[model samples]
Target: MGAWGISTFDNDDAADWLADLSDHQSLALVRETIAAALDADDYLEAPEASTALAACELIAAAIGRPSAAARKQETLTRWIAHRKPSPDTALIADALRAIDRVLGPESELRELWEETEDYAAWQADVVQLRSRLSH
Candidate 1:
């Protein structure tokens, strides 16, 4: 999945999704991405999982809880600065649920990470993202 690290935006799918998000600057896109993961009835693909995580990162940033890596993303930072969106409680709660689905057994992202030595670190990164959304 072209992953270099465990941070939400440290992968190809997420990077691409972030680029789209930056260009469009649409909160509805963010909601749709998270819902893609949260509402999936079958096994979730790695790319979809990655995109959802990126969407959750945006939600966290909108709620004034950006991760260190998120702050370093120039495009995302610019988008956030431009939009200044304030996510409500429902979106945050859905983000949290989307995170859970990404980390769940049906997620191909989690399955792929399980085969790597960095599995724990990847899981930790996702948990940290969830923590950011929780508050």
Candidate 2:
């Protein structure tokens, strides 16, 4: 959990995942990441959760609702310019559902954040991500 801030792409896992996404330029990776989180039957790991959130952020960007932080990332910006992903409604719904799972009690990422004084801030970031995905 190499996190500097609570924004979607602020962790090592997310950054690495984004790099992979940029390299592959595949929207299926984003969908798969979100599905991984949503399909988890046991406790979701922090890295998985982080990556899912990053996937959600990508979906938001595809729909012209990128967060300020996401818009600043060179790789993500470049990927968006090149791929031009147009996420369907199902992907958006799945991203939203994955976000819910990440925020839920069974999530290691959520549990880890609960121990910090910045839990509220982290939660707010997730809520903002969900909001962005909603539209």
Candidate 3:
């Protein structure tokens, strides 16, 4: 139910734990939940960390942390594939860019940003980026 250090997988237990606590406890649980949500094994349906992040947004009551833009990008990628992004995506993207200003840019954050949703798509992009960057 929990992977205390993984941000992308098995987050329900962490979210449940986080939801029961106060702001003080929330800070710590937020870290755990985010990590769990990032773990590669978190997805059983969508392959992306977005589902687990939905849990983070609900129970953690916060979205932008660490690499906020990248996180939002991850979520948006999922939404875009579904057809269209809601207005909320823009809100989250704005918040994430603000966080990025404080955190500096997290280049190569893709290492932690890939989703499990579709390996072919991800792999192609990775290859493209790698080719471009390596040149």
Candidate 4:
């Protein structure tokens, strides 16, 4: 609950923090964070990147814009190609992992993702984890 930008809180704290926020407050925070991420020279290295991307996806869903996920995925792919072997690789990987966690089963957004035929199949292409826990 220290900041809305990262998943730094424990499960209960995160739940309470989210539950306590009004929709307007959440949207404003997320939008401001996203603007910051977008303005940064390298979002892959920016501390706000993970939260910004996830927030963008969530905000997009809230407003009925389904293309946000696809846009973010495209951005991630470009970052992967450009940043591999650089120290920033881990940051991009972590951001993807965060996105994966946010889109877990129980989320209505997860259902939207599942309805897409090849979204899950493209995971390996997007991130290079030999196994779920290996990388």
Q: How many residue pairs clash in each candidate?
A: 0, 0, 15, 0
What candidate 2 gets wrong by more than 4 Å, as runs, is: none
lDDT of 4 by residue, 1-135 (tens): 233322222123333423333333224554454455445442233234334444434333333332323344443333333433232334434434444443444333334335666547533322322122123
Worst window of 10 by summed lDDT in candidate 3: 98-107
RMSD of 4: 14.7
**lDDT by residue (tens digit), candidate 1, 8-116:** 8889999999888866756888989988888888799999999999999988887788899999999888898999887888888888888889999899999989999
Candidate 3 lDDT, tens digit per residue, 45-115? 23223333433333212322222322443433333334332224433443233222212222222332343
The alpha-carbon deviation from the true structure for residue 66 of candidate 3, after best TM-score superposition, in angstroms, is 18
State TM-scores per candidate: 0.95, 0.95, 0.24, 0.31
TM-score of 4: 0.31
Backbone clash pairs in model 2 (N, Cα, C under 3 Å; residues 3+ apart or in different chains), count: 0
lDDT of every predicted structure (CA atoms): 0.88, 0.89, 0.33, 0.37
lDDT (Cα, tens digit) per residue for candidate 2, span 47-131 = 8999999999888988999989899989998998998888999999999999999999899999989999999999998999899
Candidate number with the higher lDDT (3 or 4): 4
